[model samples]
Target: MQTTDPQGSVPSDVPEPPPHADEPRKLEARLTDADRVYRAVVSSGAAATLLLITLIGVFLLIGAWPALKEAGFSFLTEKVWTPDGQPPRFGVAAMMFGTFVSAVVAMAITVPVAVCTSLFINEYAPRAVRRSLTSLVDLMAAIPSLIFAIWGLFFLVPALAPIEDWVVAQFGGWLPLAEASATGGSLFNAGLIVACMTIPITTSIIREVLAQAPRHECEGALALGGTRWGMITSVVLPFGKGGIIGGSMLGLGRALGETLAATLILSIAFEIKPRILENGGITVASGIAIEFRDAKEMGLSALMAAGLALFIVTFAINFLAAMVVSRSRSGAST
Candidate 1:
């Protein structure tokens, strides 16, 4: 039986009832004036960014319409580029091929190096040197593209010629792609330069992602008798996979639009050049850069069309990359 104190209806042994048992708690935070102002500012910034992107797309479309109408679908398929001709015929086929090929080659070289560099910085570097190394890598990205172009043109192109020749000699018979008639200035050289340009940015992204891998999981793996390398493979690599992909794609986009280095390193040719080691390839960005000064009205329109294609492709790649990153462990998607 419930006991009652002398001065109270119920004894102290009875638990007190909770306040507002039937009412729902306010889950949302109450916005103050400052919070409202902040939200409004952020919303305006986002809206402005979207408006700018829309304006750019509209501009490109308007500028490209004349060329697209003149060439029709053949604008995509034809291999020749002679927009200033009497009838004005041109196509992005070969230039687009070069763009993709060079970008792919750059990624092929950049990804492994970036991944290794990031892993080293995050997991293997000495604490004393880590900060310095990270700063150095980041500083590399701030260097101008024109500097890289000039360096590649004057130094890198000549230095790579011997190596390119050796490769061609070793594999020319069995690997058709390894053969080259001229190795001084080629798509391969452009790709190498672009890869160098892309490495720092890609590595920075990957390092940040890898650094964010759950420390507890890494410790757990080690506690379970896994080696450091094993722990890294099991914990870090898996955690940063999405970031790696995202970083690589971002690098690819950079490589695709790289104008100066490619223009300086590549010997332009209109035909499709599957042999990257040969001294003949041209990318869309380089094409536009080279033709812009001398281009007539039709040529300018054709160049704009090419730029539109590249813009669309780059946008798609980065969009997909953002989606991938958002789905991964490292993304703050919310």
Candidate 2:
């Protein structure tokens, strides 16, 4: 047996161990001051945003308090809105109904087409075609709201006349919607115009969200011999459902606040009724637009109350969207 030295077993060139096991922790400790500054900046930004929203809500409430106190809760339920005489009174029921109906109709039209268009752009269209279409959609989106209003007034409204006429001729006896005349502007026209207005926004948001779908999921579906449609319906759509709902709600919110085009297109009456074809219906925004010039002092406050109502509606929608997004992130993490 050969004698082996312990010193020979260890390499002479071996380096000493690192100073401490928690060296990384020490380095991080040194960064505490910088981390504190960063956290302060983030907290300040969040506080600023909260402050701004709070100020807005407070201002709206202050402006609306007189009308709200006088009318009580019946302001929401009452149909009459005359503010000119003694003991001035106003109500938002008709405006509320019109706003809801038009928004609903717009969403009904926009959601399907937008989702389909986004799906096609994301999964079906060739890359070159998708690029071109996406550019066109973006261009359409960038067009000013006023321009859309003008174009709808001149072009789309007229173009829709024949289609409206045909629908009335074919379905008039069966449905109340079909009773609407082709020439005059109506709820159907305003709803359709709003739908058109929202199409680009909805399509763009849905496309971006769907494009962010997990690549591996899609690949796995394809590998499993799933058809393109089947893969989209099952994998892509389920993944994007939350985003889609959020986008739809945002679009609906836009429709609710739309003023110029809706005012120009929809026949505005103060009374509430169900006939979409009826000569008069006015959304809250449009009502404000139409009546603001002639409104007296209390009437002005009444309009502000409606504006406050719209603001609350939109804020609620955004809050709901945030909740949906949070839930989606949690589900994805799990």
Candidate 3:
């Protein structure tokens, strides 16, 4: 029952606490404080990542200033990297060419193989075999680049020699890329090694993405008198296309930055050449790895500039990949 309190005010069984309330207010205040702390931590993490990249760019630009001042654009255009010469003529044209070309070759090999393998694993493989094969792929990803480099040097190079020779015999007369020099460390060989390295990563990514492809859509297609192949073509492939593209681009990014394998697999060269089979190729990372130890003054600066170039290339590739992925996103209206 209601009753009059102090003067004429009515009071009920449940009454509001005074301003001095303890536990509830304290808990609410604590929750708010914790939320603010969490936000600050997350914001700091993002800000730190951005700051680190900016700092790296600053350092590279500052270090490369002397070389950029003297050489101007020749550092980019010329095809020589002689630090000991009279004029100390150095250029990254050959390295940049090799980097892009070999990465392209790797992508060419990796994309199709990865896509096919991933499809089989995700769509067709029996459950028992699927787990085993996926585990094997994960094992491959865990394998060190040094191990791949050694295997490429001792085994793959020799094994591919016969194939290279045959291709040269058949197509060397017209197709420059198919032309093979006897040197085992040709760009083609390096590219193959790079492909091998990229495959596991690409396949894993594709498989994961493809696994998420709408199962009901696939079933719907199959229900409409579609064969397995027809269903995949009409439903699965379309759904996974963006994922496949994104995975391929990620693999390409890895290939572009690959240092140890590329360095060990390719015979570093200073001049640019059209033949992909040539023994002379030097990727940017490989260039830095091989040159950094011996570099002094301008040479160091040149290496810095080269590093900057690779950074720009990687950033651009990632940016473009993001655009491609966004454009190709499933369920999005064009």
The 10 consecutive residues of candidate 3 with the worst lDDT sum are 21-30
What lDDT does model 2 reach?
0.81
Model 1 clashes, total count: 0
* Candidate 3 structure, TM-score to reference: 0.88
Q: Which pairs of residues collide in model 1?
A: none
Per-residue alpha-carbon lDDT of candidate 2 for residues 90-143, written as tens digits (9 for 90 to 100):
889888888888888899999999999999988889988999999888787787
Could you tell me the TM-score of candidate 2?
0.85
Local accuracy of candidate 1 as per-residue lDDT tens digits, 1-334: 6777678676777665556767885565558999999999999999999999999999999999999999999999988989999888899998999998889889999999999999888888999999999999999988998988898889988887788899999998788798887687788888999999999999999898889988998999999999999998988888888889988988888999999988988888877866889889889999999989999999999999999999998999898888877777453431
Q: Which residue pairs does candidate 3 place in steric collision?
A: none
Q: Which scores better on TM-score, 1 or 2?
A: 1
* Alpha-carbon shift of residue 320 in model 3 (angstroms): 0.6
The top-ranked prediction according to TM-score is: 1
By the lDDT metric, which is better: model 1 or model 3?
A: 1
Error of 3 at 8 (Å): 16
Clash totals for all candidate models: 0, 0, 0
**Cα distance off (Å), candidate 2, residue 2:** 56
What do the candidate models score in CA lDDT, each in turn?
A: 0.89, 0.81, 0.85
